[model samples]
Structure formats: structure tokens, C-alpha cells
Target: MLDERAAGVFTIAATPFLPDGALDLESVDTMVDFYVERGATGLTILGIMGEAGKLSSEESVAVIARVTARSDVPVIVGVSAPGLAAIRALSLAAMEKGAAGVMVAPPGNLRTDDQIASYFQNVADVLGDVPWVLQDFPLVTGVQITPKVLRRIFDACPTCKMLKHEDWPGLEKISALREQEAAGARKISILCGNGGQFLLEEVRRGADGAMTGFAYPEMMRDITALAHSDPDRARDIFDAYLPLIRYESQPGYGLAVRKYILAKRGAIAHPTARKPGPALSEAAIAEIETLIARQEARLSAL
Candidate 1:
């Protein structure tokens, strides 16, 4: 099981679909191999990047089983859903299939701190003995959990093991949480997720590692390694890819960009994103190619 000591890059994986919109099971195995070869210490499937909502429950379980069977590292399954029954059922299925743990993002319509705490308390009650990660991504979940509220939930539930910290402008929150731990709060492993945008600063603020889906797992692996051992070198490496990272940070277009790049890298069979998603504009593709060229040049110089 993944614990507080878990660190390094835990890449959020993209779900591959065929041109006909069927789940590409073959591509799932290929994608797992790609992630492990690229330096992912862990892999998260069915995440926001994985297009979790678009999948049926049966497809979701199949994807989890396929990934766990092939992944060398621990696999974290995103089981976030509208109801505890659904979340509980999915998490149990994932655990049965050998998942390292499951991840939960706060459901929508949770506005107040008390409501948030209560909701997670119910989640904990349902999860019971299953270890889970608390995904505190305000940008997507629309639920802001303050450090105080988070501490309460952590205290109330011991099963919540990790924090998938993706709160924007949340550096102070990380610092504050570390301070609390120093002053005797329960220590929760914090793996940040924001497409590697604020990765360097996050590490400086005491993040364990990156859990973002930025397509380039090696960049997360190398940059965080140097951030720990050599700040100057980490910055130089981070700077080279900063431009492209920013480009790929678009809200809805990000996952499509990841799939496109993954296909080009031979990680997946196709770059077919499911419907109801924005298509990659010609201008967006041109921009990404230019950034990739610049990124390669910078890396070559380094």
C-alpha cells in the first residue's frame, strides 16, 4: 500500500480510446510500460486526465485491472464519484484488482468547511480499511479545503494517507501544513498535481514529489531529483521545459495534448480523445510543436 513515505513522480495516466471510441485495452498495457520506462515511480489511472467520467463502471474496472497487472510500480486508482456507494464499490473493485490505493476528489456542491469535513468523514466511513488519497484540487472540484479543515479530516480519519495537492497559489498552505507537522500534526505525504507548473516551488515548500499528469514523467523525475540535491541545476532543467509546461497547462485542452504527445512517443496506439471534449485547434497544435522544438533545443544545449 502507498504510505506517507511515498514520493517521486506518480504520473497521472491518460486513458486511450480507439477512433471508434472503444477502450483500447492493448494501449493500456503499452502506456504502463511507457510510464515505467520514463521513470514513474507510481501510476494513477482513471484520473481527471484519464477521462474517468467518460468510462462506464465495467470499463473502469477493466482499465484498473489491466494497469495493475502490467504496472511495475504502485497504481493509484481515482474512484471519485457522486455517491459513497459508487465510490465504495469502485474502490473495492480496484483494491480487489491489486491497486495500491484509491484517490477521491471532493464532490461538487460542497461549499462550507464543515460540509467538506462531513463529506470526507462519510467517505472515510465508506472506505473503511481501504487506504486513500485526498485530492485537494480546488480548480476542478470547486471545493476549497483549508488547512484547518484538512487537519480535522485527517484527525477524524486515519485511512486518508496522501494529499494530491493541486490547489493553485497554495504554496503557503504547504508551508503551513509542514509547520503543523513539525508542531505534532499527523504527517501526510503530499504529492502535488498541476501539470508540473509549480513543481520546483512546491518541492521548496516541502512537497514530497509530483503527482501531476504532464506527459513528460522524466522532467518531473529529473527536476525534483535536482531540486533536492542541487537547486541551481534543478532550475536550469526546469527552465528548459517551463515554456512547454505552460502551454500544456490549458484547462480542457491539456489532456488532449498529453494524448497527442503520448501517441507520437509510441506510448499509445492513437490520440483519439472521447467526445464532448474540445478538439485541438490547428493553432494549438502549431503552438505545441514550436514549444517542443524550443524545449529540445534547450535540452540539447544543457
Candidate 2:
């Protein structure tokens, strides 16, 4: 289970697909192996980046069962749904298949602090014994959870074990949450998750680690490890990869870039995203190649 001491990079895995848009289950093993070799301490599947919403309930369980069976490290499945019943059902199904924990994001309609806190209370009540991660990604969820509200949730729900913090421009929120804990509020794991863009700063502000998926998770591992030891060295490594990080962080286009890079590296056989997501343009592909080239040279220098 995730806890206050949970640290190191937990790679958010992608759901690989064949050229015909079928699930490439073979790539599931290859990609899990790739993350472990590259530096993932744990794996989070069916996250936003993993195209979780696109999968059916049966497909979701199949993916979780396959990944947990193959992975030696703990796996956290994104089980957020539009209702408590669905969330409860999915969480039980996921844990029955050996997931260490499940993640839940607030629904889009939640507006006030009470709504957010109460939503999690319902989650905790429904989940009962299952541990969960509160995904505080306002940009996607449109439900802003203030630090004070977070403390209330902690006070109310003992089962909310972690926070997938993605409130952009909220490095101070990380500091605020840690400060709240220091002031005797319940302390829980805080893993920053904005695709590793603010990883260095987030760690410095007191995030436990990253629960983000960048094409190269080794950078997150190396950066977080060095940041804990030598701040200067971490900044040096972070800057080297900043250009590519920015490029790969595009909202709609980012996943395509990641899939292409993974396929090029032979971690997967195909780079196709599911239906309704556009393919990468020739020009965009060219730009990514340039960024990859520059990233390589900078890494070698470092």
C-alpha cells in the first residue's frame, strides 16, 4: 500500500495498441520490463495517460490482472468512475486481481470544498478496507482542492492513503500540505503527477516522489535521487531534459509522442493511439526527432 514514506518514481504506463486499434497485450509485458529496467520502482496503470477511460470494465480487469501478474513491484490501478457504485465495484475487482491500491479522481461536477471532501468520504465508505489515492488534478478534474480541504479529507477519511498532486503553479500547496502535517494533521503520501514537468521543484517543496509518466522515467529517477542528495546536480540533469519534457507534455498530442518514442525504442510494436485520437503529423514527428537528438547530446555531456 502507498504511504507517507512512498518515494522513487512510479511510472504511469500506457495501454499499447496494434495498428488496427486492438490491445497489444504482448507490449504490456515488454513495456513493464522496459520501465523496470529504466527506473520505475512501482507501476500505475489505467491512469489518464494509460487511456483508462477508453477501456471497458472487462478490459480494465484484464489489463490489471496481466500487469500485476507480470510485475514484481506493486501496481496501482486508476479506478475512478462517475459514481460511487462503479468506483466501489472496480476497486474490489482490481484488488481481487492483486493491485496494491486504487486511484480515484473527483467527478467533474464537484464544485465546493464540502463536495470534494464528501466525495472522498463516500469513496472511503464504499471502499471500506481498500486503500486509495486521491487524484488532485484540478486541470483535468476541474475540482480545485485547497490545502485546507485536503487536510479535512485526511481528517475524515483514513483510507485515503495518498495524493496524486497535479495542481499546476501550486508548488506552495505541496509545502502547505507538508506544513499541515508538521502542525499535527494526518500525514499521507504526496506524489506529484504533472507528467514530471515540475518534478524537481515539487520534490524540493516536499513531494515524496513522482507518479508521472514521461517517455524516459530514468530521468525522473535520477533527478529525484540526486535532488535528495545534491540539489545542484539534480537541476543540471533536469534542465538537460526540460525541452523534451515540455514537448512531450502537450495535452492532446503528448501521448502520441510518447507512444512513438516507445515504439522507436522497441518497447512496443506499434504506436497507435485508440480511435478519436489523431496520429502525429510529419512535422511534429520531425520536431520530436530533433528534441530527442538534443536530449541525447545533453545527457552524454552530463
The backbone clash count of each candidate, in order, is 0, 0
Candidate 1 per-residue lDDT, tens place, 161-198, comes to: 99999999899999989999999999999999999999
TM-score per candidate:
0.98, 0.98
TM accuracy, model 1: 0.98
> lDDT score, residue 297, model 1?
96
Instruction: Give the Cα-based TM-score of candidate 2 against the true structure.
Output: 0.98
Q: Per-residue lDDT for 1-302 in model 2, tens only?
A: 65556778889999999998888899999999999899898899999999998898998989998899989888999998888899988899989999989999999999988888888899999999888899999998889899999989988988888898999988999999999989888889988888899999999888988999898989999888888799998998999899999999999889999999999987888999998786899999999999999999998997
Worst 10 residues of 2 by lDDT: 1-10
Q: Against the true structure, candidate 1 has what lDDT? A: 0.92
